[model samples]
Structure formats: C-alpha cells, structure tokens
Target chain A: MVRRDEFVLNVELSAEPGEVIVLLGPNGAGKSTLLEVLAGVLRPDTGRISVAGVLLDDTARRLHVDKARRRVGFVVQDYLLFPHMNVVENVAFGLRARGMRREHAQSHAIAWLERMGLEGFERRKPRELSGGQAQRVALARSLIVDPRLLLLDEPLAALDAGSRPKVRAELRRHLESYPGCTIVVTHDPIEAMLLATRVVVLESGEIVQDGTPSELARHPRTEYVARLVGLNLLRGTASGTVVEVGPHAVVAVAREVSGAVYVAFPPHAVTISTDRPVGSARNVWPGRVTDVEAHGDLVRLTIDGTVPMLADVTPVAVADLGLGPGSDVWASVKASEVTVYPA
Target chain B: MTHRRPHDWRVPPVILVPALVGLGLLLLPMAGLLWRAPWARFPDLLISESVVTALRLSVMTATAATALSLLGGVPLAWILARSRLPGLTVVRGLVTVPLVLPPVIGGVALLMAFGRRGVVGSWLDQLFGVSIPFTTVAVVLAQTFVAMPFLVVAVEGALRTADHRYDDIAATLGASPWLIFRRVTLPAVAPGILAGAVLCWARALGEFGATITFAGSFPGTTRTLPLEAYVAIGAGDIDTAVVLSVLMIGISVTILIALRGRWMRAT
Candidate 1:
C-alpha cells in the first residue's frame, strides 16, 4: 500500500528470478507507483517487500532498506542520463558510486557497452546519440551494477515508430539472457505481448488480470483488457451451448459448462448486413449503426440492438452496404467463432 | 522579388528610446571615468605601497567572503529548493533580507548579533577573550553578510529548474545521498554556482558602507580598496580616488565579460 495525498494504491506482486513480467495498464493506473515501491524509492504504508529472500520493506517490523542498498535498477521512461557526463562515465556511474576505482569502473563499463553494441561510442554524450542508442546506454548503465531486479518504465516509448521494432527485438534478446527478474511497464499491448513472459494487467490501482500473453489475448476479463486485445467481450450465464449475454442469447460451440461465463470474439468475427442475415450463422439480431470508425483497412461499426456489439467490415463492403450512423443493420455471428471461458 | 531579412525587424520608438537611454545611463559613467583618469600618474599610482596594500586586501577579503558564502549558501539553497519543512517561506524571506536591506543597517544588525556586547559576541568575548569588530575578520563577515544572498538565490534557482528525477535515478543506481549530491547534483549545478560566486565576489569587493560601520577603516587591516578610495576623496586627493575608481571599474568589467554568456542565455 502506498499513499500519495488522497490517492491510495494497494498492490501485491511477485516475480521469479528468470521471468520477464510486463505490467500493462493505461495512464493513472498506478503501474509506475508499483515499480517505485518495488525499487525501494517509495516506502509503503503497510506492506512487506522481499526480493531474493531478503526483506527490503516490512512495515510491521519497521524495517526498510535504503534504495542504494536494495540492488534494484530502475530506468525511467525518458532515460535520465547524467547530461554532464560522457557515455562511458554515465555507464560507470553506478560502479563508481559503489566505491570502485575510476579506472576499473571505466573498463567494466566499456565491456558492457561493447556487449550492447555501443563500441567506439564511449566518449559521445547522450545528446549526440539517437534515441535507440541512448536507450541501450541506459540499459547498460543499469545492468552493470548486477542488480537483483531490473525495472524499466516504458523502455521503448521514447523510440520512433521506424526504430521501435528493431529496438524492441534487441531489448528482448538482452532481457532473455539476464539472470535477474525483470519488470517492464508499458501501456502498449503489442509491446507487452512481445516482451513479457507473463503479463499483469493493472486498472485503477488493481490487478484485473494476470496470465500469459496468449491467455490474455484469448480471454480478457474486463472491458479495458478486452478493448486492449481488440476483442468483444460480454458476461453471461451459460446453460450448455446457449449463453444469455446481456439482453440476447449467444450460442457458442464449446465444452458444455453451466455457470457464469464470458463470451469473447474478435470484431472481424461479427458480420453486419443491411438486410437480416439468414444463412448458416447460428445467431442473428437486428441492430442500428450507432458509430462508425476506420480501423486500418477495415471499418468498425458499433451496432446497438438486442446485443450491442462491434462489427468490423472492409471499406468496400461498407460502401456497398452504405453503412452510416443510425442505419438499420443485422449482425450475425457463427457459433464456432465465439469462445467461452469461466468468468 | 526582394525579401526582408528575418533579423531586420523594425523597433518601435516607444521601446527603442528608453532602451538607448538605459544603455547611455550605464555606459556614460564608464566613459567619464576613462576620460577623467590621471594618465600621467597612472603607473605611479598603480604601484604605490598604500594602493597595493588596499588592492591586495580587497581581493583577499572578497575571495574569502565568496568562499564562506559557498560553504554555507549551497546547503541552504538545497534546503530552500528541495525541503518541504514548515515556515520555509519565512526562512527564505529572512535569507534574502540582506539583498534589499541598506548595508549600514546590515552592519548594525551584525553588530547586535556578533559585537563585543552583542548576543553571541558577548559570550565569545567572555569565554575566549576575542573581539570581532574593527578587524579584518569583521570586514570579511560584513562582506559575507551582504553578498551571500546572491549566491543563495542563484543556486536555488538552478536547483529548482534542474530535473530532480536524475537524483532518483542515481539513488537506484546504488548511490548514497551524499554521493549523489557530490557526484551528480554538484556537477549539474556547477555553472550556476560559478556565476553566483562571481556575483558574490564582485559585490563583496565593492562593499564599503557595512565595512566602515562595523569594521572601521583601519589601514592594512579593514581598509579595503573601496575604503581607501573614500579616504582619498575625503583628503582631497582626487587623482588617487580616480585611479582607485578606474581600477575597480576594470575589475567589474572583467566580471561582466566572464558572465556574458550566462546573461545572454538568460535574456
């Protein structure tokens, strides 16, 4: 638990030594606060934080380790490199601060920089390097200290779209070989999917979902997670193959399970037509187009009817159907297209 | 087609007239000093024993005052910029009071606080058989009392504008608070401290009213160049006074030139 003025955040998290956990959340979700607490920068009001079997914080015992002794490396979103120092000095700062000799620290920093593919860039300042290069230097700076846990807050958010993929892949490769637990905070689901061994979704200071990337993509528990993974989710009670979702019943082809369940399907799984669909689609309902938005090459329409849902259709199909707001339309979904999981 | 240069914007008379007047007001005095300087006696006056003693004393006392200010003012500035203690506004106001208070009044306040019969000074006199007034130490103290506000204000401004997240990052990198301050915070604000020290030294070099009141103008002791100039004027030695004034003006111009880059960036 951490309190900042009137806002209070309570979170319980743990990661194994060889795991890369991504804390995925929207803005104001308290993800960065959790990382700060874990890194021993902010003391919790009432909680215990232990890393590698060593107790770092225990409010009951009134034991709190200083941040300098916690062996936690934190890289912020903007990568606050010491602007006055050169690249080698910046990377060697941690070692020098820990009482190592200057020459030895510089040599170690050079080795780490070379490993990060930053050779011949030791004397260059941070401003002279590209965003990606600076990020790698920040990582090298943090990793040189051999921390027990590494915390990166939106590590790749500073990169341009052109370099994001290459930098992200390189970051993933580096993280794979690290021996400590790593926690990365990002709001981009694609980034979370690409970098996380397990993704923990945080919403409004609470953990809403925790699972593997594929598990979260296949089954999202809340509207935020569902929208993040680009899926339509609805809560309902399942009675064999038919599930009462909202005001309408949705028939799903899954193992027979009778209880509260969630029905999830992609927007592209939903088909919209000006006239009522009457073929092999197991479920069909008449709905009016409430909103239309362009989603890449497909046009996504929010239809409101018996079961309000989102439907994605190609631009060509939208022009043919003349889809617009307030246009009456019939939405249909095949039984096999919807996946059911216990809520 | 002819194009207007981007730098050739027309200045309105409303602003241009006062701007030129302000420039003239600042430059005309220096020009008058140059015009009235005793050129024939310049070398003789510059090498005089009394002039050398006063100049050496002035430079030494001003540097000592600047050093004292840095010793106390840097930590005070950090507290002012970073601490969230109660009544800090009152503390800041008190620290800056010297900037606006009359220097004579500052000397009187210093006397009340550190004179022979004053609060702390009385105890020191009784316990240690020491008196601070009418000594070179008193001159340095007076100068420091009047000039330290410049250093504090400059350093606090720099600390306020510096990104504090760097401190947090340093801490996470296994740096103790003291190490962070020495290795990170100090270097980051070095330019500000240098500018502040220069301003403090310049102000201390010209301090006269406070020194005359508290330290008294004792030759080879508390009589700095400014006091020497005042004594020369009172004795009707106008050439000596003009020479000393020109020497001080030259030093002031050097300081201004040294700080030109910072001033330009600020503007």
Candidate 2:
C-alpha cells in the first residue's frame, strides 16, 4: 500500500494480493510520480507506504526503505534492459545477486522465460528483441525475482498498433497469474477497463475518483472524470430555487442554489422529441444536430442548442425522429436527470 | 542542413583541400620512412642478436605494462567516472597528466619519485632489500607510467557515456554494487577497455624517453627496442636503427589491424 499527499495528490489505497489496481490519469496528472513513489524510485514529500503490512516508508518519521530492499518489480515506459547480457543472463541477474549459483540461477530463469512464452530466446540480447518481445523478457526478469509488488508504467503504450492487442492480451494473462498486488499506471480508459479490478483516476497529482469502472462511468464528480466517463458535462447559473441551464432549459433540483453551479447528465438522460412536450421537467430545446455515434443498442446524438446536450436514444427513436445529418431536433430532459453540484 | 550546401557539392574546394592536407600530415611520415628504406641490409640488420633480444624485451615489457594498466587503470576509471567524491575533477586531470606530460620529463619525475634515494624507493629498498631502478622491472614501470593513462581516460569516457539505468535495473534485481560492476559495468565497457589496452600496449612498445631516463641502457635487462635503436644510432649503426624502427612500426600496425577487425566494425 502507498499513499502520497503533496501539492494535489492525496491518495490512500490498500491493495490486497491478486488485485490489479490501475492508476489512470491524463498527462501531467502525476500518475508516474505516484508510481515512482510507490516503487521507491521517488520519495514522497509526505506520505506513508507499507508493503506486505511492513512500513516501508514513513516520511513523517524520517523512515524510508532503500529501493534495493523494496522487493518491488518495476517496469518503466522504456524497458531498461542490460544490453550486454543475453535473455537468460538478464533474467538470472536477480537470483545471482541474491547468492544463487550460476547454474541454479540459470535454470530458474529458463523456467520463468518459458512461462513468459520466451522459451528459445535465452541466447538473444535485448537489442535483438522487438518491443513486445522485450516487454515480455522484462516481465520475465522482474517476475523471476518474485517481488512482493509489481509496478508497470504504461506497459502497452510503447507498442505499435499491430503489437498492442496481442501484447496487451499476453500482459493481461500474466497479470491474472501474478499472485501479488499489481499497480499499473496508465491514462487510457480502455486499458484501465480491461486490465484493472478497480481504477483510481488522478488529476494534477490528486486522486479525483476511485471506483469500479461501471460506478465511475455512472457518477463522476469532476469534468475531467465526466469527460473520461464520456458524459456531456455543462455548467450554468441557478435562479429562484431552480438551476437554469439557459433560457430554453431549466431544471428544479433538490438543493436551493442562488449562484453559479455545474450540472452533469449521462448521454442517455435526454429524450429526443420532434416537437416540444408538455411536462413538469421544465427543460426543452430545439437543437441543431451536431454529432451522431452508435452506442451499444443505442444511437448517441449530440445537438447544439440553448444548452448543447448528448442524447443516447435508441436507434428506433433515431429512425422514428428521422434524425440524420443537418436536421432540427427537440431534446427534453426531466429535472431529476441533471446532477447539479456546487461549482 | 547546417551548412546549406547541396549534397552532391558537399565536398567542394572548401572541404577537400583541408581534408587532403590533414590526411597528408598524418601519412607523410610513414611514407617517408618506407621511401628511405635500405632494403638490401634490412635482413642482416634485423637478424642481429642484440636486435632479437631487444625485440623480445619490448614484447615482454610492453605486455607487462598492458597487464598492469588493466589491473589498476580500469578501477581508477570507474572511480573517476562514477564516483562523486570531492576533488574528483582534479583527480581526473591528474590521471591524464602522462598524455600531455613530456615523456622525458615524465621519466625524470618517475626517477625523482621512485629512484634509489627517492622517498618510496629508499623504504622499499631498506624494508625488502629490493631495488627497482635500471632493471627489467624498471623498464616495465617506465612503460606503464606513460601508457596506463590512455586506457584509463578511454574507459572513463566510455563509462560516463554508458546508460546508467542499467545500474538501476541491476540494483532492483538484488545486485549489490560489486556484482553490478563485475557483471554489468565491466562487460558493457569491454570493447572500450580492449581498445584502450591495445593503444596502451602500442604506446609502451614505442616509448623512448621514459625508458632511457628511468631505466638506463643495459643489455638483456633494460634495453627494449627503442633503447636498442638509440644505442645503435650512437654506435653509427644506422641500418640497425632503421630495422628496429620498422619492426616496431610493423608490430603496432598489426595490433591496429587486429583491433579494427575485432571491435571497430561496430562503429
């Protein structure tokens, strides 16, 4: 477990064995710094880190464990392989360093290489391997040490398009088999969803959202999170106990607000109407059709109007409304659909 | 891009003249020596007993010098290149002194420091009944003093330019400093070290001033090829001197060829 709080990052996480927790965030979000702090490559300005229930680093108490004794496997953005050593020797390094004899170390390395699906690459140097192959060799070398924790920094980001899917699948299989707490750092939503049991979204060195992928997609507290969850987020003012998005759109919320605020709604909330409807929801707009995308079992429509709204209506509704490029559409939403929060 | 010249016209008079001049400056001496060869007496002059003994001593002492450089200079380069100790820059400068120091003056400096009445030399003599001056050991010492710096500087530069993340990787793999140095650092710089060793050996074989100043001219004990040539020149034996020079040049050229084939292919 690692926790850091300085500038903007204030994260507290305790990962159990066999759990893959991915730290996901955009660039400059301090995701790499968090991983570095956890891997003992960087020291936190103020934090406490414990691994296997042992207090590894407690900056408040001036306690810090050296990286060499951290027993954590780290894979950086670029696979930092020793070019001089062949695959077998590179894998055998950790064992030899821990006082294993050359023959025994080599045997263990061979076994791990075989596990990584690199059986016959023992004699090849790091320069001879492709990106994915090098990543696998790096994984084999790191795992052969049997570290207590595993840290991967954008492991699949360095791969090309043709190699990405295959390598990601291979890495997923390896992560499943690794019986240790693994923390993978990445900002790609698909990668986080595919590889992580739980996702921690960091922004400007702070954990803004931490939850299961489904949960975060449904409820996001920040615009960054909303964008990541693919929600059309908007901000507006409130008047007369009603949050007014604009002249044509206003929603009565549970809270009585008198000033500026933020309102977020999932794309599925809006209902496309050919004409304005008589309703208590008090939100209506004749919008210009801006964008259209096919979601699972639904067609997502983006319309520019008094308040630009993304509506996830069924394809049947799309066809019924005759919605296509350059057509007028009325989008209406109930007050309850808008999640109004103080800005 | 920097010069803004067309690729086809890149080697115009502005570049070609200087390039040819530089090549000529480097090759003109070897050309002159070959042109002035006394080809008729070369075999007889080269086959003399003194010539043979000097050649053997040159091989022996130069090899010993190279061995000494590898044993001591590699670690020195590592320390200078990697360590952050105080006075490090000063130490690095001192290591390269032999490269710029006049060879004769360097020999005199060696004599002043390790001579019979010199500080360390007197104690060594008194404590162990050992004297190092004007002997085969002295010849080796003189050669090493001048040649070891080349190896150290070359290796230190290589080490400084090496990828340091390999050290971090090794550390995470449970490798302590010594193991990393032996398994990673040493092997990574092996080619540079080898190149330096070859250059050091060649320099030692051709060393003239230091050998004569520190280790005086003596047959079978101190007379390496250069000292033998100097002695032959003094005795009006120009043919023998030329033969020794040619032999030394030949040995150094062979080493260059072998190393070029072995390691320089990477460049």
Best by DockQ: 1
Quote the positional error of residue A20 for candidate 1 in Å: 0.4
Regions more than 4 Å wrong, model 1: A248-254, B1-5, B261-267
Q: Could you give candidate 1's per-residue lDDT for residues A1-343 as a string of tens digits? A: 9888867788888889989999999899999999999988789999999998999999999999998899999998999999889999999999999899999999999999999999999999998999889999999999999999999999999989999999999999999999999999999999999999999999888899999999999999999999999998889998888898875556565568789999888999998888877699887888899999999989999988878888999999889989899999988898888889999
Residue A329, candidate 2: how far off, in angstroms?
Answer: 13
**Candidate that scores best on TM-score:** 1
- Each model's DockQ score: 0.81, 0.56
Q: In angstroms, how far off is A39's CA in candidate 1?
A: 1.5
Task: Give one digit per residue, the lDDT tens place, for model 2 in A1-343.
Answer: 2334445566778889999999988898888877778777677777799988888899889999887788889888788888878999888889988999999999999999988989899999999999999999999888889989999999998888888888999999999999999999987888888899888888876787888877667666677878777786776788756877767566666567778887777778788887777776567778888888888988988798877867888988888888887778888777777777665
- Tell me the number of clashing residue pairs for each predicted model: 0, 1
What overall lDDT, based on C-alpha atoms, would model 2 receive against the true structure? Answer: 0.85
Model 1 alpha-carbon miss at residue B114, Å: 1.4
On the 0 to 100 scale, the lDDT of residue B61 in model 2 is: 97
